[model samples]
Target: MTFNLETERLILRDLRMSDLEGMFELDSDPEVHKYLGNKPVKTKEESQKIIEAVIDQYEKYGIGRWALINKKTGEFMGWSGLKLNTKMNGITNFYDVGYRLIKRFWGQGYATESGKKAVDYGFKVLKLPELYGITEMEHQASHHALLKIGLKYIEDFYFEEEKIKLRWYKIENK
Candidate 1:
């Protein structure tokens, strides 16, 4: 079944082929990719592939990041939710809470709001023991949102593959 969730002003649901336009709008912006490897998607096909990958994750792992939509405006804002991360950061088979919003939606508290819902789902609904978050070390906005959603700063680690340092955060199911 497709995942669906609601907050005060947003609706979180499974990513679909229909979201290609919005996905492209969100991922093709250079500003949105500044902290995310400085690589914004150059074409709509790349955005299509991304949505496909997330759809595959749902079929394989039973969970994946969901599309974030404005409840009132019916606008596709971006995506947020939990993903099963494997063999990243020396951790295996763990849940990661993440979010990305359209640039215009930034600073509007959407990240923090949706992140909290993802954490709650991981702990309460999925019965996960812990959840993790990774952000570029210099991303102050993400740092604030992760912390606000109750994740504690763990440490900075260098990702050998990406050749960049990142900050790790975590929250236990306690």
Candidate 2:
């Protein structure tokens, strides 16, 4: 069964193939995709594959990225949730809280609300020992959200793939 998580103004749920267009729009914004990836998704197929992969991840790992929806209008805003990032150094293979909201929805506290809920879900439902999040050094917005969710900055480094300096934030369940 697909996981459906809700908050006051947002709904986080399994991504559907139909979400590709909206997802592409979100990824296309250079400001939105800046820290997450160096580029926007070039094709609808790429978005579809990514959504399908997220679906598989949810089924296999019991937790994965959830598509963010606007509760008021039922519009696809973006995605936010937890997943295992096996490539990271300190907290590889653990739930990593993340979010990508559209430009229109920026600065509404949706990211923080969703992130807080995600952290609680990791600890209470998934029973994970920790929750972590990563943001580029220049991303003050995300850094603030991390702090709001009780995550402390743990490291600063550059990833070879993105070639960008990043700051890692983490919080242990304990």
Q: How many residue pairs clash in each candidate?
A: 0, 0
In angstroms, the error of model 2 at 150 is 1.3
Clashing residue pairs found in predicted model 2? none
Each prediction's TM-score versus the true structure? 0.98, 0.94
Tens digits of per-residue lDDT, candidate 1, 48-165, equal 9999999999999999999999999999999999999887788998889999999999999999999999998888888999999999999999999999999999999999988888
Top TM-score hit: 1
Report per-prediction Cα RMSD to one decimal. 0.7, 1.3
Cα distance off (Å), candidate 1, residue 69: 0.5
* Candidate 2 lDDT for residue 57: 90
Give the C-alpha miss distance for residue 64 in model 2, angstroms: 0.8
| Lowest lDDT block of 10, candidate 2 | 86-95
Q: Write the per-residue lDDT of candidate 2 for residues 85-153, one digit (tens) a residue.
A: 888754457668998899998888989999988998899998888887889899899999889988999
